[model samples]
Target chain A: MKGMTIIVQTITRLVKIFILLYGLYLTLTGHLTPGGGFAGGVVIACLYILLTLAYGRQWALRRFPRRLAGSLDSVGGFIFLIVACLGFGFGGMFFVNFLERFFPGRPFALLSAGTIPLNNIAICLKVAASLFLVFIVMAGARLLEKKDRTYDYKQEEEE
Target chain B: MIQLLPLFVAIPLGAAFLTALAAFKARRLADVGSALATGALLVLAVITIGRQGVYPVGGFLAPLGITLVLDGFSVLLLLIVNGIGFLATLYSISYMERYTSKYKYFTLFLLMIGGMNGVVITGDVFNLFVFLEIASIASYALVAFGGEHEELEASFKYLVLGSVGSGFILLAIALVYGATGQLNMAGIAMALAGTDKHLLIAFASVLFLAGFSVKAALVPFHPWLPDAHPSAPAPISAMLSGVLIKALGVYALARIIFNVLGATPLFGMIVMGLGVLSMTVGVILAVGQWDFKRLLAYHSISQMGYVVLGIGLGMFILASGGDSVVAGTALLGGILHLANHAAFKSLLFFCAGSVEFRTGTRMLKELGGIQEKMPVTRLTCTVASLSIAGIPPLNGFWSKLIIVIATIQAAFTYPGLLVLTAVTVLVSFVTLVSFLKVLRYVFLGALPDAFRKIKESPFFMGVTIVSLALLCAGMGLLLVPAARGAILDPAIEALKQGLGYGSRVLAGM
Candidate 1:
């Protein structure tokens, strides 16, 4: 499929960075704010999805390959686990906010809430990557189906 | 000890993700990583056997943050889940070689394990639902891993039904939350204590029964099992049939009915009635199947009935103010059978997998004389078949015997229970007959032309099947006095305490 209209593409190019930055802000400030990893992650995922729609699959694949997104998904989940396991090294229980002991920042701040903000960031990474992977795979399946149908049509014509 | 609780869920989650990340670079990372992760889990399960404690996640206390409980009941389930999970992972190292993308397979496998562990350890009802969804989704994907027409069909069926079950569970949890304003199990039970018979609680209870019965593959709700179990890779079939249903379905149902909702004689009768239905109908249907894995799947439903019957009987006795000894004996039989089935049923599935791996078919009529070619698989299959058939000295025999004796003793008091006792024995006899058909058709007949050159399964597969077979042989020893004291008694005591669990957990915290 070709790209969308030039106007749509131009607007997406201009607005995509702000959308991504807002998603970043929401994820980083999740512990105190209403929007957390799941909501903000969807927002971030929307940016890429918008890019894919505006520029087509080929353009998106060139910038952010499916393999990289898949790898990032796994790495994000591992980071979350590592943060939880680090609690043991800090002489506390599993999932304990060990960072609170070292840095008891003021409440309602972005850096506060111990390990929670870090966990939010990790989840945002995973959710964003996984959602994109799902989208790509589904789109790829549609393309394959179309190819199969056209190939069958050619074979029938030859027959 | 309490701190070790979260490791059950955390270890596998970490390993799965790391494998997913690193396996792209090093192809062998998935195999080594999952094996090590499950290995650690088995050791952790062993070390925490008799210890009981509560961990409040994030130090937010029980009523607010999630709590992980390591009671005797949870410990028993942990052993079964991790022990079988380790073997399944080990077998997959070799068995999954034929399938592509080993890393993705291992990632999903460990996630399923992590989810099961989370289900058993979590003390909050809503947390249980979350873990249940995680495990269910993973299993659904694993079932369709091969992407064959049959596999996809079965997986879609399972996924739809499983989602409906989850919906019922969520609705029930919402009802309970609305009624009690509590999410922690102990707090819910405390709030539910002595509350007069209310329709809301009854509605929640019925929803729990329907939801969990579907998960457990009980009769009338068991259409998906026969298809889903046979379509997956063999090791996966073993895992699904072995511990997943029991852990997700039976354990959750029993815990809620007995501890949270406070078991009553009426509920006991409903459970027992369902048990008898599955027991009679499952074997009856299993008797006609020629497909190896499909037959085994039907038998899973039958065996689960035995577990539910024994536990249900115990619940009836306890609620009706009958003899505590009899109640203890009955529940012990039920719980013991659960563990015993995990070993033998998984062994049975592994044996079927081995045959399929070498010969490329699971249809009983299409294969013959496998015993001569794959002695290890044949021997393990025989042992597992005998164990399931309740032959003497095998693990299945001891548990079935106890359940039978308990039922007969209950008959002396009620006389109506005599029907259940007779059904138990009759079911055992029919189980033997059906397995005899399997034996004759798959192993004892003359060799087929197509299968003559097939060899035995790989080294790790043989090791896994043999180890599980040995467990099947020796599991009866768990009934010995010393072992019983350490393992079975504590779990039974926890259930018998009923609503008292609320105060004990609260006091412990």
Candidate 2:
């Protein structure tokens, strides 16, 4: 049973990594393609959801951890803001695409599209962590309900 | 100065997501983290008001790519969104303890804030819709956070009405897009400058107005608000009344009408009619309410009516080619009232939460004589109530006074001005009467037998309430010339520019 669980966990982890990579791919190509920050972020969150479901809550918690997600959310928002601020600093007004002048690299390249790629990544991190946190709180409440059994008793009493 | 514009949305969004993630393990950390995030945003909003300029997004020239404009109008909204958001977060820290899932609450709270910020900052019309939905969706879910019968019912009502409103807005956007072939607001303005499709524009404008009016909970579309606002948790109640309606509904409506569509006299008349209906009806309904939070919710509709009336009058004057000074005053009073309302309303909701926390009920008759037990709460509640009633020395009075003055100056016939003014005064009286019922039943009467062991709320909650009460007093200072010029004038100017917004954004780029 232990070996089977281990194999299942490994497979789920591999699948999650694949999803994460796919989300990144979409985010990077967001400006040129239909998939953008919100779509990519939801995809990333789906991977996290899969991991949590496949390998129990404890396993998911141990790997991703709350602190890491929190930091990543903050970092993503900050990067998006910084990218906008950089435009202002270049005397291009707030949120102007300053990278066009400074980095002026090819227009449709992976690293091109000015601040679009950075914004995509930032939005991805934000949405993923936000949705994951929502799931955690909701699922945690359910888990607590299973252990306590008091809610069930109370419901019965009320009924 | 311009560099900090993006921080308004970024800080709150970042903080909300971070708080949500952190709360999973160190559950206690969510409160402080969310508070710090909103606090930072509030400060940034203040700084933004001082830095007057447009900030385009992605360095792309205007009319082609998306832009984020931070002008007087946007800054005014930023102050309201971030300021109330911070206080609401503070209140939530203690008030949300009863709920089983606190982290989820904070996460949704932040997403709502991020969405509102995005709505205020984005220069692209399509982007505004996206952000508006983000905020609206989160709010829909938040209303049902309690997961009770009433909460579920209220959430469904809000969702249906809100979805209909959103549909109207989307249809309006499609119409505008088809007409102008541009997604950017400024670009659309430029395209429509010499157009002769008055009937189509009018139709689209009506759709936008109806949609936004629903979101704002205007009298005609206000059935959902009383149920929705009272159903949410207290902090969220504060958010919905204090900021959400104004940002998502009133602000968006005003921006599109004045800046994009060039506010016509017909639009102004519709706005004023809605305002009068809401003010009269909301107050009358509020007076009969037994639920404390529900009463406050009804009053939100009435107070927002006052805001719409003032702004509508300004639009009428401007569209008629009347004196610019009087128009400016009207606009200033309307916008200032928006800010003032945020402070007082949130404070009122916080007080209601404190009462619920201590007395375990929001029903007026069920609550009695807990003032001695919760002195700080009583004081704050009194201050907030007095402010809302437009008592002198409080913030609400000055803004109302300005509106009344501007109405008279705008050459409103004596009877018309007198009647509107009378309605305003009557509404204030009704507000005071309802609050007095609250005071008498909840604070002055004999303490209920079941509440003997009740205690004051936690320190954070008290701190949040008291600070808001203080703002109730301090915000009156905006009437002073220096303060008015520094904070309020620019916002009025931004609106007065009308379709000039297109040129300004283009110029910045």
The numbered model that scores best in lDDT is 1
Q: For all the candidates, what are their Cα RMSDs to the real structure?
A: 3.2, 5.5
Best by DockQ: 1
Q: B493 in model 2: Cα distance from truth in Å?
A: 2.0
**Runs of candidate 1 exceeding 4 Å displacement:** A102-108, A143-159
Q: How does each model score on lDDT?
A: 0.90, 0.84
lDDT of 2 by residue, B257-353 (tens): 8888778876787898898899889999999999999999999999999999888888877887878888888887789889999999999999999
After superposition, candidate 2 runs with Cα above 4 Å error:
A1-159, B194-197, B411-417
lDDT of 1 by residue, B1-509 (tens): 77778999999998988888888679888888899999999999999888998888867787777888888889899999999999999999999999989899999999999999999998899999999999999999999999766888899999999999999999999999998899999998898888785789889999999999999999978899999999999989999999999999999998998889888888899998988999999999999999999999999999999999999999999989999999998999899999999999999999999999999999999988888899999999999999999998999999999999999888889999999989999999999999999999999889988987898899999999999999999999998899998889888988898988777787764
Give interface RMSD (Å), model 2.
Answer: 4.9
How many angstroms is residue B323 displaced in model 2 relative to the true structure, after the best TM-score fit? Answer: 3.1
Pairs clashing in candidate 1? none
CAPRI tier for the interface of model 2: acceptable
**Native interface contact recovery, all models:** 0.74, 0.50
RMSD of 1: 3.2
Compared with the true structure, model 2 gives a TM-score of: 0.83
